[model samples]
Target: MIGSLFSRRRPPPMTLPDPAIVVPGITATYLRDDYPLPPEVIWRVLPFQKHFGSACLHPDDLRYEAREPALIRPGPLYEVAYKELIDELRYDLSPSPEAEVPVYPFAYDWRKPLDMIEADLDAFIDEVIERTVLTRHYYKDGYDCRRTVTLIGHSMGGLIIAGFLQATGGLRTRRRRTCPDHRVSKVISLASPFRGSFEAVVKMTTGTADLGLGASSSREREAARLTPALYHLLPSFDEGLEVPAPLPRTLFDPQVWQPSILRSIETFVARTSPITRTVRKRTEALFAGLLDQARTHRERLDAFRLDQAGLGPRDWLAVVGCGADTRTRLTIAALEDGPSFVLTSDDRRNTWPNGTDTGDGTVPFLGAEPSFLDRANLVCVTPDDYGYWELEDKALTRFGGGFHGILPNMNMLHRLIVRFVTGAPDPHQKTWGRPAPGVRPDAWDPPIPGLRNKAL
Candidate 1:
């Protein structure tokens, strides 16, 4: 009797229905599969980063440094899969001929140098212009084509967005008779080190961290002696570069270990005074410059907000993944306290690590989003409760992992996209998590099927 009274029961899981494959309201004018697909009907034309460390050494032309991630290894099957899903979802968007398609133009290997990556930005932008121009005729006219576009980047893709946005005002391409509608609606970054990923900074700062950092170890040194010019530009040293092609589904690809590797690298760097000091010295100026650029972009957006120019309620969204049992005190506190109040850890002096003040282990609250948008536009969700499981229609319902790579998995995030694109709610009313304050449609309790009172 005593045990029964004290017992705690776990909540029953919520059941979801099959995904609804709705036919798109619009029709395509071009011969559906032929050249010049419309922008609205296109799924995603994603560009990936190559090895940064080897950019200078390779005999290949500099113009070709950036390669299609699909072209490399494992085939471009992922694009096919993504396209199928888009078809099923019935989104009218197509990859515009005018869409940007710039490659990293670095070495194929992971350890490419930072300077090499930095040097390629101008060329990359050129590629975006050229590709977008080449693809312009693909748009199937008269389908209420949206002027603005969305950018969904992962890993180095996130870095690309940062660099591209920085060059926005100054970077110009040859003007065309008619500029295709090239506006950016939203930037969706997955597992991105937005505020300069800690890994990037650690490697670039310390010459010893890994190939990504341009460090030479017994293993690397024993092999071909890479030139110092070649060493600094590539990112082959970092372990993250080890991820092989032929993408895997669900959660992180198992290659992306969190906090642990980062912690270990930090520990190693901390213990060796020589390495620490050297890295700090080397990276200070470069990091400062990068940070300054990011800040400038942030400032511009902030100013845009101050005057209520070019933005509206619920216009932007920032999504991040957190581990189970993670505490978001800093994030909650930041939200509650506003940006003016500085957040510090227990010692009062020790503040939450940079880039992740409000994030789980990787993302920070402020960096997760700029101050330009209303707080209500931002939403943080966890994988524990929402993993790629079905709640509504099976076709419609997908789950996401608890890891940081939550953005790629279509199953879990598809609903969000559907809602975002269609400007409608999931008919089932599944609850991914709480929305940031002051969002549209007013807040409603999202319910799950076969469950009462308890919502997802």
Candidate 2:
């Protein structure tokens, strides 16, 4: 009896299977389609190139057998403007999408107010439930939604998640359609514009036709216009600043270059120089703060009492960012008479114009990091350690070589997702043991800075 008592009581730890991979159902949300497009491809394709390109890149890799889309439009300009009239722009309302209208995504349902992002998220949750079914991982397993569902968003998607969690009830508890077991277990934000960006603020202030009409009625329009960095582009909106038709006889041709017009350009250049300087300095500071925020965000998350939300220390959470040359060329491809919108990378490091230190073109690191108001559960990961990319040749294993959507498109991203989201042991985690001694943050050796994160 004693000999048989202790026979192989438990299997080896190495042999146990990971659970995160087996779960199904994931939803990725997109926004803003107000601009007219060819009706032939309206629902078939998205106007935003980055959005369409990223979605297509993940064809081979994504783990879940099924994926659906949740499309949200920003609130109407007239509704959002009501706050500006009453001057009720609190911290919560201060960040409203209305202030930056041109850049705000389009909305489908405009009957209700879009003040709290949490409300928008409730709709997203409803959509997910409408599209998915709840089921146990195994017959013996307990009913837990751990790896059943995930939420992936980019740019404003990050804003919605923050609003959802911070608005009214927490994200875990704000369920429109509770399945008793199914709930959002994971969130991934890629190159999202979280903090206010200088480029955006600058583009907003300038009254060039280049600014999309969406921002024309934004609450922040006036403030952004007064900003120094954006003031230079305002001359485009001038009407009859220089009238040479001898004391207003009906109307004068304002197109002619008069003395007043020359003075306008001169004054604009002089006034904008200082504002440009400030933008540069502030943008750099903002990036540094974002880096520090990522390091400390987890600490602040511990204070929230979310025990009922089904989230725990064991549950996984992460954030990813893409880095590239900030000074990408920008242009407005084709438009009727309105301003041409910018076309560039979404990351701040890459969006900063030439001579600037860093950006993803559109979003900066500090802005990309979760804001101070957020609950702080985000786990920041560089492209490499997170297993976002893998090259066919070991020689080409570089950070930037595995670019934005490269991780998901190359099957590398897909594998990493299934492994992490499903609770499976990651095969690549072992490679990133820790930093070696004397590995300088700005070291210039054989490998490049972009590829450095992965080698670690």
Candidate 3:
């Protein structure tokens, strides 16, 4: 009886599932700012009451909310883009029948610079390790069951992960010592523009292209242009033929801007005849700021490329989309007389010297393949069609069926992702052939036509 009373029962061993962090692309986080009125403000006065609507006219009256990162959860677009993956992963990685997956959707201020975002990511990872895993594990046992994390990123998110891996020395190298606690077990990058995109340059020059996201406001557009991240997404000049030397104009020169901006400036100058001193000074100042930022961006990109040389594949899987018609600018030449710009193309036919190439719409096929990755680490999946047939029939295919935006929602692609993440059979083992038009086969629902060559 005394022995039975003294004996104590030990709890069951805790088995922690490996954590997978989902790093979303740009504009995945929502930002809000709060403004507070000063205590001296009187709302009841006659003048204040009469101009109540104009109260916001004063900059001092505005109190903007501090920038905070929060996940997009309740929007219609969010439901389609991110909700499915979050739900599926939660169900797949739940530690208990009632518990959710340890996977976290990391959101950040997309308007901020990439370097600032990188710091936030590092801190977030450390916090997750300590608070979510280590804290719980230490309370029960001394060591945590899961030590490493799997990073899954899409588009710019993939670039963020790449930057993080480089900063932390996560890639395996003979000379560099890897950090044990912050080690990455596996990395899945989808449609990442490691080599940058010409589309970004087009947007910067003309401000005409849409970034897949719905119509943006003037303020949002200005913010996007000002953000250094857009500069980082400049086209990889080395992808094809080099632009002729001693170029008369480039993106760096505001004088070479498209007709719209030039026309506005010309009209202003004409209206004011000998442009007023104050107006001239303001215009010159504006142009100076734009030129300085553009020059700074180019320098930063050059430095980033030099530092990113050591990023070799350790346990990386790069998924690239192909087949769909994609816009690609091969070369840019300035008009001899003035600063007008002309873009050349590098299509297969070469029939149209300035035609677009076949890719996943937003990201070119070549740009999706990072120069640092080995051939074996890459997998190119070409969907049967751009997945917009349904909307096309309804005359609602505004964005077209490009595979870039719909990658995460593709049924076949999702299966491939799950198989790879779970360590199942090689998802790329089968040789998938493109299905003929209007002929749906049962082999792999919406067949993923494998790429003919992986050299790109």
Best candidate according to TM-score: 3
Q: Give the alpha carbon lDDT tens digit for every residue of 1-456 in model 3.
A: 421221222333544445677777654443322223322221111111111121111111112111212121211123345566766776755645644446778876554446567677777766665555334433253223333566788777787777666555443222212223344666778777776666665554544343434343343333334445665565554544235556433455555444444444333433433444565555444444545554554444334421343333545667766665565554555455444445434332211112224456677755665655533445655655234552243212333224565565555555555555554454465322232222223322221234223222
Candidate 3: clashing pairs of residues: 33-65, 34-64, 34-65, 35-63
Q: How does candidate 1 fare on TM-score?
A: 0.43
Greater lDDT among 2 and 3 belongs to: 3
What ranges in model 3 sit over 4 Å off?
Answer: 1-17, 36-77, 95-99, 134-146, 170-181, 214-221, 240-244, 248-314, 336-338, 343-357, 385-401, 426-456
Q: What is the C-alpha lDDT of each candidate?
A: 0.31, 0.30, 0.48
The clash number for model 1 is 69
lDDT of 2 by residue, 1-456 (tens): 421322213222221122211110011112234433421111211121222211211111121101123222432222221122112211111223322101122232211112233465566564443332222222112222221334444434444443444343234353322123435555444444344233442344342122122223332332232222122111211121222333221111122212322233333334433344444344333323322332232222223333434444334233333344432222322234332334344422342222223334333344454433222333323334343334343322221222332222223334333344444454444322111213333441211112223433
**Number of the candidate with higher TM-score, 2 or 3:** 3
Candidates 1 and 2 compared by TM-score, better number: 1
Shift of residue 10 alpha carbon in model 1, Å: 60
Residue lDDT tens for model 1, 1-456? 422221222222311111121111000001111122331111111222223222212212222222222121111222311343344333323223242222221111222232343345434444443343233232222111222334444434444444444435222343222323233444444433333322222232232321131333432221111222222222211222222233221111212223233333333334432444554333333323333433443334334441232323343334544332221222111132221112224211112222123343333333344344344444555444445352222332221112332334445455564455445544575535443322333542222111112112
Best by lDDT: 3
